[model samples]
Each structure stands twice: as structure tokens, then as C-alpha cells.
Target: MDETWAPEACTLPTAERPFRVAEFDDLFATHLRRSERVDPQTLDLTLNPESRATVEDLTARETECCSFFTFTLTGTTELHLRITVPPTQTAVLDGLLA
Candidate 1:
């Protein structure tokens, strides 16, 4: 993901941003089964059941530093991650899958 689109609201720190991006990269490579843009403000990631814990942990940490984002996980036998951002943060959300 290109972190260039990240806005001023991100407080993850310049040094740690790449690491965060790497974590997302790993998650997408390892467990992500499907990806969809639900709307201009939202993205949906369907991951394997095995990714529940990792997804939860990552999203939690992400929300801690980037409060502009809203991450939701829902599914019974599957892991569904819904990432949402306010309309003003659409560019940041777009960078998520880039």
C-alpha cells in the first residue's frame, strides 16, 4: 500500500508507518481471500477463518493510532473485515488497497 495518500490525521509516526503497512501487506498476502469496495467510504475484506485473531489484533492497533478509520469484523465460520472511513478520509481508505 502506498502510504503517500495517508493524511495529516494519521498519528502512527513516520518511522512506524512502513511497519504498519507491512503488517497489512502480510495480512493480505496470507489470509485475505477476497477484497471488495463496498462504497466510496467503505471496503470489505473476506478472510479465512484462521485470520480472525490476526485481523482483530491488527484492526485494534490500527484504530488506536488512526481514529479516522472504523474497522468491523463479522462472521460465523468466516472472517469478514469491514473497513470504513469518513467521506473526508476517502483518499486514505483508497490507499488501503493500493
Candidate 2:
């Protein structure tokens, strides 16, 4: 993951709130698979109150591996995200390139 791509601030209407977006890297993948479930608490580490709420809500929807998880924040300033946990090592590498 490129450190430069790390989210620095909220781009939503709740810009006053803090938020971050990070690509799932090797370390994170190892932990995620080992756990067999994505830990919301750990994921929350990169989010603000509003963004956390949004994530909590979105994660409830059923999804499949390698599918992109998209987040759209409404209100004054809109924020978008394309999150994905690739299915295989090759897929992960491909996703990173994309």
C-alpha cells in the first residue's frame, strides 16, 4: 500500500470529523484471514464518528470476496470509497495495480 494514498481527512459534509481510508495490505490480510472475520473495532481505527457509523451500516450488507466495497457520504461534501479484499494473492496484486 502506498503511504501517500492513506486518507488524511474527511471529505464528507462532516469534514470537521476525522476519517481515514487504507488499502488492505499483506499484514492486514494475514490478520483478516486468520481471524476469519473483519473486526469492526480494528477497522474503526481509521474512521471518525460519522464515517464509523457509515461503515457499521454498510458492512451489514452481504458481500463476496474480491468485491469492491463502496462508501458514499452525502451532504455538502461527498466522499467516495472503493474498498475490496481480494480473493487470492494474485487478485490482491491485480487490485493494487488497479
Candidate 3:
């Protein structure tokens, strides 16, 4: 895989909070309302109303560690999170979101 997205310096230490598979699994299992693949490298997630803060917090922390991730939230009554990653990192993104 191309290491372009994995920069040497970042805001958070990856080793401090290694990506936990269960964390994501639980987040999606409990909060996901609907999901769509905006494209091969972008995922659009519409989460339950109550899950907005949780998702925001999670993504915020994620952005600290992996600057490659682009997380955007649009809409108010119904929140949507658009997660974009480099094309070369699709597999890694899939594994994390799966």
C-alpha cells in the first residue's frame, strides 16, 4: 500500500489508542441509520439522531491520529457523516468500517 497518507508527524500517537475493531463495530451496530458509498473512496453515513455527538467525538479523535481521513457532517435534523480517504487506502478504510 502507498504510505503517502501515513505521515511521520501527526497530532495524536497511533500507539496510544490503537484502532479498536470492536469500537467501530459497536458504533455502527448501535448508531447507524443508513450508509452509502458515495464513491470507491468515500463513505456516507447517516447516523441516528442520538449518535451525532458520539460520531463527532470519534471522528474528531480519529482526525488527530490519521490526518488522511476527511470527516464531514452535513444536515441538522438528520445528521450525515461523509468519510473520505485516499483511493489507495480504501482497503484499510473498509477493514476499519466493516
Best by lDDT: 1
The TM-scores of all predictions, comma-separated, are 0.94, 0.23, 0.76
Clashes of each: 0, 0, 0
Candidate 2 TM-score, true structure as reference = 0.23
Best first by TM-score, ranked: 1, 3, 2
- Give lDDT tens digits, candidate 3, residues 41-94: 899998877887878888887787778889999877788989998877676567
Q: Give the top-scoring candidate (TM-score).
A: 1
Mark the regions of model 1 whose C-alpha exceeds 4 Å error after superposition.
none
Candidate 2 lDDT, tens digit per residue, 17-96? 12221323422332222221233211112222344344444443312221333323333232223344323233323333
Model 1's TM-score against the true structure: 0.94
lDDT of each: 0.90, 0.30, 0.72
Candidate 1 per-residue C-alpha lDDT over 4-70 given as tens digits, one digit per residue, 9 for 90 to 100: 8878988889888888999999999999899999899999999999888888899999998899899
- Candidate 1 residue pairs in clash (backbone atoms < 3 Å): none
Worst 10 residues of 3 by lDDT: 1-10
